[model samples]
Target: MYQYTDFDRHFVRQRAAQYRDQLERHLRGELGTDEFRALRLQNGWYIQRHAPMLRVAVPYGELSARQLRQLAHIARTYDRQPDGPFAGQGGYGHFTTRQNLQYNWIPLVDSATVMELLADVDMHGIQTSGNCIRNITSDAFAGIAPDEIVDPRPYAEILRQWSTLHPEFAHLPRKFKIAISGALEDRAAIGWHDIGLQLKRDDAGHIGFQVFVGGGMGRTPIPGIEISPFVAWDHILVFIEAVVRVYNLAGRRDNLYKARIKILVKAEGQKFVDAVNEEYRRILADDPAGHEQLIPQAELDRVKASFVDPAGVKAEPAVTLDDGDPAFARWLARNVHGHRLSGYRAVTLSLKRVGIAPGDMSADVMDTAAALAERFSHGELRVSHRQNLVLPWVREADLAELFQAARAAGFATPNAGLLTDQIACPGGDFCALANARSLPLAAEIAERYQDVDELVDLGEIDLHISGCINSCGHHHSGHIGILGVDKDGAEWYQLTLGGSDGSTLSGTTTPGKVIGPSFAADEIADAIEAVLNTYQRDRLSGERFIDAVKRLGLDPFKTAANAVRVSTAKAPA
Candidate 1:
C-alpha cells in the first residue's frame, strides 16, 4: 500500500525500459535461449508448455484493489486478443500456489509490450519469476486474523524493497522462498518456506520475530529450524542478508538438484547456522548502516496506512453475511472470513471446483476480477499461497453483489477449508522441475471423493500433493501428504501422514512409503478413502485424521493403504 515516491517511480520506470531492450534482443536472436532464460527469469518470464508465461509479483500476497484491477485488465487485454490471443490456446491466467499471477501462452515477441503496459501501472516484473528471490510471501490471514500477536506487513514491505534487484543476491545456487506469518495459525505454509518468520511481541513490549532457518521440500523433505527466538524488527533484513550470504557462498552450486538452501541447512547444524548469521551481523554492524539509514521512519508508517482498513471500512453498523442471501450465507460459510474490520470481511476465491484444475484461471477471468476489484472491493486483490484469490475488504452489505460477480467469473468454489480444497504444484505435466505428474493425481483424489455430506461429517483436513520432493506444493505440512517420486523410470507416489503447519511444526510422522505407479486419479482417490477409513473406524471420538495418525502411529495407516492393491477396494463404483 505504500505510495510510490517519485524516486521509487523513477527507479521502476528505468527498470522497465531496461527490460524492454532485453526482450527486443531476445526476440531479434541476439540472445540465445540459455542467455535469454536467465534474463527473462529475472524479469518474471518463463517458457512453459503452452507459450510464454509472465509472472506478476504480489509482494507477499499484498495488492491494492487498484493494482488488482490493473492485473485483471492486463489479462483481459493481452490473453484475449480480440478473437483471443493465440486463438483457443490462451484463456485464463494462473494464480500460483505462492503469491504471484502467471499469464501463460504469451507470444514471445509481444511480451515486451506487456512489460511496458505493467510498468505504466507502477509495477514491474523484476525478480518475480527468477531463481533469485521470488515473490516474498506471508500468511494470507496476516494482520486481520484475531490470534495474531502483531502485524508483520511493515517488515515484509521493508524487505520487499531491499531484496528487489539487489545485485549480490540475484542469482543463487537455487530458488529460495521466505514466509512470514503473524497468526498463531500458520496460513502462509511457513514450514515449507526456506526462511520462515513468526512475528511476536516480546515480554519487553517490543515487536520482533522468531526466526526459522532451512525448512524446504524438494528431492529431500526438511522442516524449518527455529534458529533464533527473538530477532528485533530492525535486524530482520540484516539477519536475512546473513542467511542468504552464507548460502550464496557455501550452498551447492555444481549440481542444480542439490543446490537449494535446504541442503546447506542440512549440511550444517543449528549451532553452525547461528555462527554464520552472527558473523555477518557483526560485519554489518561495523558498517556505516547504509540502507537502514536510508529507510525513513515515515516509509514504514506510509506502508502501514496502505493496508486495508484494519478497523473496518464502512460507516454502517456490522452486518454478517448470514443476514443476506442464502448464497452469501454459503459463501461466508466457505470463502468469507472475519477481518480486523468490525463490519467488513476478507472474501476468499475458493480453488476447489470439482472437475477444473484447482488453480487454473483464464486471462479473461483475471481481467474480470480486476474490474470487480476496481468497482466493489478496495481495488486490491491478494493471491493466497493456497492458490486462491482474495478480496481483502468488502462491506457486509455489498457481499451479495460481490458474490454474484465472482460466481459469474468462475471464482466461486465454496470449499476453502474443506478436504477437496487442496494444494498441488505443476507436476511433470507442466514444470520442467518435476519428477512425477501431480495434477492428475490431485484431480483423481478430488473427484473420487463425491460425498459432501461425508466430508462435512469428517471435518476439515489439509491434503497436499507435490510432483517432486521440492516442497513447492507444501507436501511436508499436510495432514495427508502425497509426494510424487520416480522409480524404475515410472512415476510413483510417496504417501506421508501427520505433517503439521504450526509454530512447532512437525514432519511426516513416519518415512513416506511409495504408492503404486501410474495410478489414475480415481485410484488415488480410493487410496485416500482407504486412509480415511482407517482413521474413521479406529479414531477416538473428536480426533481428526492428523491427530489419529499421530496418536496411533503410521503403521496402521500404512498397513491399511497397502491393503488397497490398486485393482480392488476402490473409493466409488
Candidate 2:
C-alpha cells in the first residue's frame, strides 16, 4: 500500500479545514441550500431521501489495516440506525462499485468531523463526488495476478495525484471515471468506465496501454471505443490530457443530461476522434522535452517503489485439504483465486451475506477484516469492483484459520461469482433518485438459491440490480440484469439478459438485451428462477449461464419467464 507523505497529510488536513469552514457558513445562513449544493457535493455530502450521505474515497481500492480501523471508527461514531422492526444494528457502512465507502445516515452538521476523521487516516472525500474526476480504480489483483503484464497500481497512483485537484479539469462537463486493468481478465470492468486503460505488451516486450474512451452506462449505455490501439507507457498522461481537453472544449454543457463525454462521442462519432487526435498532436508539439516532462521517470519510480511485492513468502508443495466440510470446499473453489506467487492466493471476503444488503458492512466486521488482513495478508487488503473485500496476499497455509475467522465475522459466504453473490446499489431505501428498493430483491434472489449445489449448477453468473437508469449497480453489464422502474406509480423490474463486462483475453463484451415487459416486484425472484431453469434444462454439458444464454438467444428464457409470471397472476387466491 502507498504510504502518505507529509505533503499528502498536510493537503488533506487543509482540505478538511476548508470544508469545515464552508459548513459553518451554511449553518450560519451565509449560504443557502442551493448555494451550498456544489460545495457539499465536492466534499462528498449528498442530501439523500432521509439524511445526508457521505462517500469516502478508497484510492485504487487499497486499504491498510490501520485505515480499515479508522473507517470502522467513523462508522461507529457518525452513522445512525433507524428505529423500527426493520432497523439494522447501527454502525454499518456501504461499499460502492467505484471502490468507495458510503455512510447513509450522516448528519449535516457532522460532515466536517467526518472529513477530519478520514484525514487522520490519510483518506478523504475529495473528488469522490461532484463534476470532477472521481476515484481511479485498477485491477484488484494488480501486482499478484498470475496473468498480469504489469502492475497498474503505480500508474493508477500517478493518475490519482495528477487528477486529484487539477485546476484545468476541476469543473469539466461532467464527472469522469478512469479504470486500469493489468491482468488479461477484465475484472475492473474497463469497458464501462469513461476512460479505460488496459496494459499490453508489444512484440518487443515493451509495456504500454490500450486506451478506450467515452464508455459509460446510464440512459445511454455504450462500451468505450479504442482511441489509441497502443500508447507508450511514458506518454499515457499526454494522451489522457488530450482526451480530456477535447471533451471539455467540445462537450455540451447546457443540458446536464447530455454533458457526459459519452454523449459527445455518440453525437459526433468519428469527428470526435479526429478532434482528439488533433489535440494530441498539439499537446505533443507543445512539449519541449518530448512528453517526458508530463510524467517524469523519477516520479514513476517513486510510486513504483511503494508497491514492492511482499517478501518472506516461500513456495510450498501442493497440499490437499480433507476437512470433510463440503461448505469449506465450496468456499475454497469460489472465494480463492490464483496468485503470481506459489503457495499464496487472493481471498475475497464476501459482503453478500443472505438477507443483508449487498456491500453493507458493520463496524465490527470491518475491524475483524482488518485484523485478519494484518495477521495473514501483510496488513493490506483490496476492495473488488464486485463489492467485496480482498486479502490480496494470503498464504495458502493460512486458509483454514482465515476461513473460520471470516465465517465467524459473516464474511465467508462461499458464493463468489455465483447467483447469490450479486452486485447491487443502495436503492429507494437510501438514494432519492431510486425508483424502487434493490436490496430486498437481491436478498430474495440469494435466499432462493442458498443451496450450494444449486449455485454450483448455475455457475459463474453475474447478476446485477439497479434501482434506476443511472445504472449505479452496473445492471447493464450483468448476465441477468434487473432494472427498477416506476410505472403508474408502481414498482416494476425490467429484466435484461446476455450482457457482460467482456473478457479482454477472449475479446468479447456485449450489453444486456431486454427480455420482455417489466414484472411486478413480487414476481421478480420466480421470474429469475424461470430463466435459470431454462438455462439448466437447455444448456449443453459444462456450459456457464452467460455462455449458454449467448449460444441460445433470449426467446427461450423469455418464454419461461413470461410463463411463470402469467401462471402466478392466474393462480387461485
Candidate 3:
C-alpha cells in the first residue's frame, strides 16, 4: 500500500476545499448546470437516473482497514437507502469493475462532503471520471502472486502521481484507462484497457514491459495491439506520455463516439505506432534527464519499501482442512487462492451473495468486512477487478475460523468463480446511460443457479452482464456474456460465448463472439440454461465451459438456446 506523503495529503485537502467552494456556488446558482457539470464530473460526481452517484477512488484496489472504516462511515452518513425491504439499513455502496466504490443515491449537495471524507483517509475522487486518465489499476494480487515478475503497485503509484491533474492530458479526446499486470495470468484484464503493460524479463534479467495499446470494449470491441515488445522499466512513464500525446493530438474530437484512443488506433493502424514512436523519441531528446522520468531510483526504493511484506510473519506448516463440513470445503475450494508465501492464502470475500445485487454491500457489511480484514489480513484489503473484496494475506491455518466469521458477516458464499459470481454494472435502474436494467437479470440468474452441486459440476465460468454497449460490466470478456439493449420499447439481451479475461494463464486472449439474435429479458435465464445444457452434452471430458464452446463452436449452443426460446414461446399461456 502506498502511503500518502505530506505534500500528497495537502494537495488532496486543497482540492477538496476548492471543490467545496465550487459546489456551493453551483447550489447558490452562481454557476449554471452546464458550467458545473464538467467540474463535478472531474471530481467524480455523476447525476445518474435516480440520484447523484459518487465514485471514490481506491487506488490499485488497495485499502487500509482505517480507510475502509471511513468508507463505511461515508455510506452511513451521506448515502440514502432505496425503497424496498432493504430500506432503513444504511446505504449500500456498489463496488465497480474498475475497483472503485460507487454510491448511487448520494445527494448532489453532499458531493463535496464525500470528497472531504475521502481526503481524510488520503483518498479522493480526482480523475476517477471525466475525460482524464482514470484510476491506474493493477493485478489485485500484484505483490503476493507467486508468478509475478515484478510488483506493479510501485509503477501504478508512479503513474497515479504523474497523471493526476496533468494539464496536457486532462481534457483529452476521451477518457483513458491503464492496467498493469506482472502475473502471467492477465487478472487485471490488461488486454482490454487503453494501455496495458505486462511485465516481462529479458535474457539479461532486466525487467521491461510488453505494451498493448488501444484495446477496449464498447460499440467496437477490439483487443489491444502490441505497440512495444520491450520498454525498459525506467522509460515506461515517458513511453506512456508519448502515447497519450499522440492520441491527444490526433484522436478525433468531432464525434464523441469516435473520440477514444481505440478509434484513433483503428483508423491509423501501423501509422499510429510510427507516430507514437516518433513522439517517444522527441520526448526523450528534450528531457534526457528530467522529472518526466517519474520513477527515479530513490522514488522506486521509497515506494517499494512501503509495500514490504508483513513483518515477522511465518508460514503455518502443512495444515489440513476440516472435511467434516461440506459447506466449508466448498467455500475453501472456490474462495481461496494460492499465495506466494508458504502459509498465507489470498481469500476473496464474495460480494455476489444470492438475493443481493452483485457488488452491493451495506454500510454495516462494509464495517464487518473491515473488522475481518483487520483481524485476519494485516489490516489491509484489496478490491478485485471482478468486483469482490480480497484479503490478500490470510493464513491457511485460520481458514476455518475466518470462514465462520465470514458466514456470520454475510461474506461467505462458496461461489467466487462460478456462474452466480457474475459481474454486472448498475443498469437502467441507476445509470442514466443504460438501455435496460441489469441487476434484476443478474439476480434472476443467481437465483436460478443456487444449487451448489450444479455450480461445481458446471466448473469455472465467467458470466458478465453490461447495461449497454459501453461494456462497463465487461461482457465481452466473460465465458458467457450478456449485454442489455433496447429494442423498440423492450429490454433485450445479446448473448456471446468463448470470451475470457485470460484467467487461464495461456498468454493468449480472445473477445467473445455473439451467439445469435438478442433475447427478451424474461427469456435470458432459460436461454442461458439451454446453452449450459448444450455445453454439458457436447463437452469433452474435463473441458471448461469456455474451452467446450471454443472447440465445439457457437452453433450448438445457439441452436439449443433458440430451441428453448421457440419452445417456450409456443407453450400455452
Q: Rate the local accuracy (lDDT) of all candidates.
A: 0.72, 0.87, 0.88
Higher-scoring candidate on lDDT, 1 or 3: 3
Better of 1 and 2 by lDDT: 2
Using TM-score, give the best candidate's number.
3
> How much RMSD separates candidate 1 from the native structure?
4.0
lDDT of 2 by residue, 430-458 (tens): 89999988988998888888888988887
TM-scores, in order shown? 0.88, 0.96, 0.97
For candidate 1, write residues 1-573 as lDDT tens digits. Answer: 556778888887787788778878877889888987888788888886656778887777877656655665666566643332224534556667787777765676777777777777777778776567767788777766766777777778788888888898888888878888887777776766788888888888987888887877666767778778887776677778888888888889899878888788888887558776776667567765645533456766777776646333554678744535655565677788887767677788776666566676655565677677666665767778778878776787888888888888767666776788898877777667677887777777777665666666666777888887766677777788887766656676667777766633333222233433334343455667888988889988887766687789877777777666556433221
What order do you get sorting by lDDT, best first? 3, 2, 1
Candidate 3 differs from the real structure by a C-alpha RMSD in angstroms, to one decimal, of 2.1
TM-score of 1: 0.88
| Residues forming the 10-long window of minimal summed lDDT in candidate 1 | 503-512
For model 2, the superposed segments whose C-alpha errors exceed 4 Å read 83-89, 291-293, 314-318, 504-507, 566-573
After TM-score superposition, the amount by which residue 526's alpha carbon in candidate 3 deviates from its true location, in angstroms, is 0.6
Candidate 3: pairs in clash: none
User: Can you give the lDDT of residue 96 in candidate 2?
Assistant: 89
